[model samples]
Target: MRLTDLISPDAVFATLKASTKKQLLQELSDRAAKLSGLPAREIFDALLHRERLGSTGIGEGIAIPHGKLGKVKSIFGIFARLERPVDFEALDGAPVDLVFLLIAPESSGADHLKALACAARMLRDPGLVATIRATRDHDALYSLIAQRSKPYAA
Candidate 1:
């Protein structure tokens, strides 16, 4: 569940603008469509369905919106640093400025969970989170995640 395996430099956004969660999801959905070759509406629907279950926002100004798609052959990820924080209904009621969008195959139960956990672990580091916030270069942000990810970790 290494970050590098799921994300590339192009998938990283240095600064994204979205006034609301839905708008953000829509924008990401569009990008995911291009990257995954899936329909934007389909991806958006999947994310919205997952959100109906509960907000992916885990607090500390971060959110990880993810879902499984039947047509997906592999896991995909997109990371972004928002130009402005938006209300994400985070558990701690904090606005989300950093986000990671993950899409995986429907049958990838264990692999999907591992990837989600991997992203969570990476984002949970306060120092690293601070660094991600401070950095504005897209490639640098991707590198930070890639450098912090422990490939051997469970």
Candidate 2:
């Protein structure tokens, strides 16, 4: 699945302020609830459950917090660039400024993994991430994510 398949222009946040990981997840869940038609509490709980397993903070100031829900029919995503980096218990112990929250249907299985891989592949590029962080314009951020990201950047 492509990144665009999970995210849209409205889902892209250029400058969100989150002081802590828990608050960030809660905010993401609230945003996702509006777009995904799922309850914010359920989404927050699912993300919390996933975090309990391990931090999704995948390094390079990025965190991809994801979860699955029975009510979801397809994968949905929310991306944010924080105004100030927040501690996410990243593997590299780096505070995260970039975040992507992915929510998928409980039965998605392989499709969910593929969507995660797609987002990870796109944002893993240092050059692209730099460009994303360089602009605060909502439309521009959306454009860069929608247009400039490489299909797979390792």
Q: What's the TM-score of each model vs. the native? A: 0.97, 0.95
Candidate 1 structure lDDT: 0.92
Ten consecutive residues with minimal summed lDDT in candidate 1? 145-154
Global lDDT scores for all candidate models: 0.92, 0.89
Q: Count the backbone clashes (under 3 Å) in each candidate.
A: 0, 0
- In candidate 1, what are the lDDT values of residues 1-154, reduced to their tens digit? 4788899888999899999999999999999999878999989999999999999999999999998899999989999999999999999999999999999999988888888988898899999999999999988988888889866233
Per-candidate alpha-carbon RMSD to the true structure? 1.2, 2.3
User: Where is model 1 more than 4 Å wrong at Cα?
Assistant: 152-154
Say which candidate scores most in TM-score. 1
User: What C-alpha root-mean-square deviation, in Å, does candidate 1 show against the real structure?
Assistant: 1.2
Residue 110 of model 1 has an lDDT of: 85
Report the number of the highest-lDDT candidate. Answer: 1
